[model samples]
Target: MSKTNLDIQLKTIPESAGVYQYYDKEGNIIYVGKAKNLKKRVSSYFTKTHDSGKTRVLVKRIADIKFIVVETETDALLLENNLIKKHKPRYNVLLKDDKSYPWICIKKERFPRVFPTRRLIKDGSEYFGPYTSMKTVHTLLDLIKGLYQLRTCNYDLAEDKIEDGKYKVCLEYHLGNCQGPCEGYQTEEDYQENIKAIREIIKGNFKDSLGQFKQQMKDYAEKMQFEDAQRIKEKIEVLENYQAKSTIINPRISNVDVFSIVSDESFGYINFLQISYGSIIRSHTLEIKKKLDETDKELLELAIVEIRERFNSKSKEIYVPFKVNIGEEIKVTVPQLGDKKHILDLSLRNAKYYRMERFKQIKITDPDRHANRIMAQMKADLRLSEEPRHIECFDNSNIQGTNPVAACVVFKNGKPSKKDYRHFNIKTVEGPDDFASMEEVVFRRYKRLLEEEQPLPQLIIIDGGKGQLSSALKSLDLLGLRGKIAIIGIAKRLEELFYPNDPIPLYLDKKSETLKIIQQLRNEAHRFGIEHHRNRRSKNALNSALDTIPGIGEKTIVELLKKFKSTKRIANAKLDELEEVVGVSRASKIYNHYHKE
Candidate 1:
């Protein structure tokens, strides 16, 4: 593009602070940027001296420029985030992994056993990870199983399989590692206590756990039970050793994110490490093949924001090897010498390792090329912050006026977070109004999120057309969080997927891998909502039959569930067995009604 075109574009822009964009011929996005001063930020690109290989290449393709004017630099900071998600122009940095991570699963039941796997689904289980290393995860699991003798099998106690003498104790029992709960080597009461202690350790309540272990050891020793105290002493020592080995790298820099970058002419790599309460979370990386001044602290701020949001960072302090500005009570300090040097060196190494990893992935991916296309097109379409990594989608489901529920599924880097999935037994809205239902669900979701002081999502995808879209908008506005989140409604136009918020539904080119990725995410969320809705419906029907019995009200129903496990068993119960249950009587009128059916 020429200076005359730039001048023509400048005629309508404001003399304020915000972000701007440049698009090439054929309407492809070429560059994305933010400005502390909108007028000055845009004007500088046209300056004759503002010439570099990167700038010149971008400027040459520029067919037109667009700008967003805001109140201050900070507003620009936030608006830049929204625009990046909306537009995803080709030139922005994306710093998160797209693959779903692994989580350690422990089924929620009378006897919970921990198991390790990458796949997570709704199975009434308590999940512990999504931790980075399988080796580390397995090692820890093995230690707990070996030392504590906890059950590692997936068999449910509810299945009437608690016959202790029937099954042989596994090798873990011989190693004195298993509690032998499976073989009745340990009393059920004692096993439950041990499980509670293990749970405290898994939850990082190490202090309380250690204290309890110490008390047990001391009590045994004082009672002249020297052998028992010695064994308990070993367990306490193991717990203490684990805590000691997992030391935080830095204590002074609380709530900090340290970043490092390594790049060359063909590919650039960015490594981001987030530290909360001082422990170093494994570093995350992004590769940018397209050239940029992105290594600078100002641009790095956007990447840092993505990292924090992706991990749901709880830290308030962010330490960077280079300087960058951000929110919270954050201090961005650059270390010049001394002890900080080792950390900076580590960050650089992390960047180098990541760069090499990307180089390997790029042999097949062409990451920079894909990034260039996505970033450019995204900005034009969405008008975003920088790039959208942590996008969350919401959907409401019901079956003919029964079992109303809403699902809030989070997608970080184009994949769903099963760990973060939420089910809302929607209480505020009634009937089949998707609009009012959506409005109530969205409001309830964000209102509590805001009160809890969680940051809003970059973009929110709702399932429906204008009615659903507008309902979401109204709820957002009512809660005073309208512009804080971008709303997109997915609607079906005739036979095609349509986003009604757009002037026209976006139709991806048939060969595009990116569209295939988005489609998978949308489908996953829909399946999740329907499955949760169906489960609730099934449970409600089961309970309805029991709820109507003469002696069985909601409370008695809850007690029966707590004891017998499920309605299937209750429905099939003989009068003698039902009468044997607590709060149940054989002569009660309920017995007559149940048997008559």
Candidate 2:
């Protein structure tokens, strides 16, 4: 590790994307990093001045550097994350979990027993989950207990022993928890039916068991056994309740692994979600300390492999936030919309929350420093001149050129400020002209705020690409507020962030809190705008139908609607009911118009 040898090593370093490892004098890896250009990145450590004490110490301690060239930046990122996690370098951030997860195991014995276990033994037993919470495990067990009679004994239920009648009915059998299969009181075939149902429940497939329960309930009801039928009905209700709570996404998205990561300069938080029949059976977040700067793609890919291995996941497909080089054996999907995107967002949210909680715990010890760090990170991550303490997003909604509306959702200090939200009808824009509609809404929204002397947002997010952004820019220019606010447009497809006068869009890390908040603002604006549009359309549709009736004035229609609540109800109303609301003449005319149809 002489200076001359270091210089020669630097010269040999290729200008390529790859993972680099730094070793100390003791021959132990101290740090791992990924870079787009290895020669430039590694060279800068020695040539540049680092403000951070940790970086300076790291540079001084680096006795040797080793790098592996990769085909792409993503490959470099994945390799770096994997190597750091495996080596657990002293300078690297490590995942801080010390507790093993609990799994529900169904023993493969005669009259099988189902219970929670931490150890995985290869004894042909079916394992359901390495559940993140023991409470969830107990809840599922209780639900199953309520639905079936299971034995609570360890006695072998061999057929010959059971025929010899060596065992007596136990307390569990007397309490109705077991069917006394050991004493031959219950047939094995019958008990196996319940086991089959329990297997389906464990797999998160409730349809088959629910059908069987319904059929049993009907059989009891037909046999004039009211109490038995009620008991069976309760079991059905319990199963349905459990199913409703467990299912979180589209049932078609079965047997898949979901991985998302949120990382900063010092650490990375990776969340893993195991989905079965669209229900999340297991979820956990691992907090990894960064040895050096690692890309989110790299951290997430490493986490996915490690988590899947730990959970014994055999899923062929995985949902990730972006494309990375995991392997050819698994299909990686970056969902853009619908249930897949929602589940991916859910996983990312879990990781983000875990990171926030960890930060909050640290902030308790050093509040001021933590606050300053957060503000600085926010400013840098969003590429903003100042901290985005106040933000607003605008969205336009219309249906086939009808009831065009816009909504503005406000956020203060990264949380939704519901009171400040505003809705606008597209007064100036005709048809479904989204660009013009965006212009009118932006102008009216800010123009009124400006005239009223209300505070303006530090950031403005237009929920569209170049067209909507340009339209909004026109408003800002006309109002002389173009340069005052930092505004950007986020396209729905690919989520590309567009800047003014910049043709190329900026793609932020998918797991970054800044991008997540922007997405939240956009979704909220769209939801608010669509709600307003729906309300306006419903009111118009209600009034239009009644307004077309002969002899029905505004006052008469209002009276009719106030009594009937809807035009459909009015149409279905008897002559007398209509006369009770409107006048007799209008009522008769309305009745005739409806009856004539």
User: For each candidate, what is the lDDT?
Assistant: 0.67, 0.86
Can you write out model 1's per-residue Cα lDDT over 168-219, one digit (the tens) per residue?
6788778765756665667767777767766655544456667887998899
Q: How many backbone clashes are present in model 1?
A: 34
lDDT of 2 at 40: 97
Candidate 2 to truth, TM: 0.58
**Best TM-score goes to which candidate?**
2
TM-score list, all predictions = 0.49, 0.58
lDDT of 2 by residue, 155-176 (tens): 8999999999889998998898
In candidate 1 the C-alpha lDDT for residue 554 amounts to 77
Once model 2 is optimally superposed onto the true structure by TM-score, how far is the C-alpha of residue 195 displaced, in angstroms? 2.5
Q: What range of 10 consecutive residues in model 2 has the weakest lDDT sum?
A: 91-100
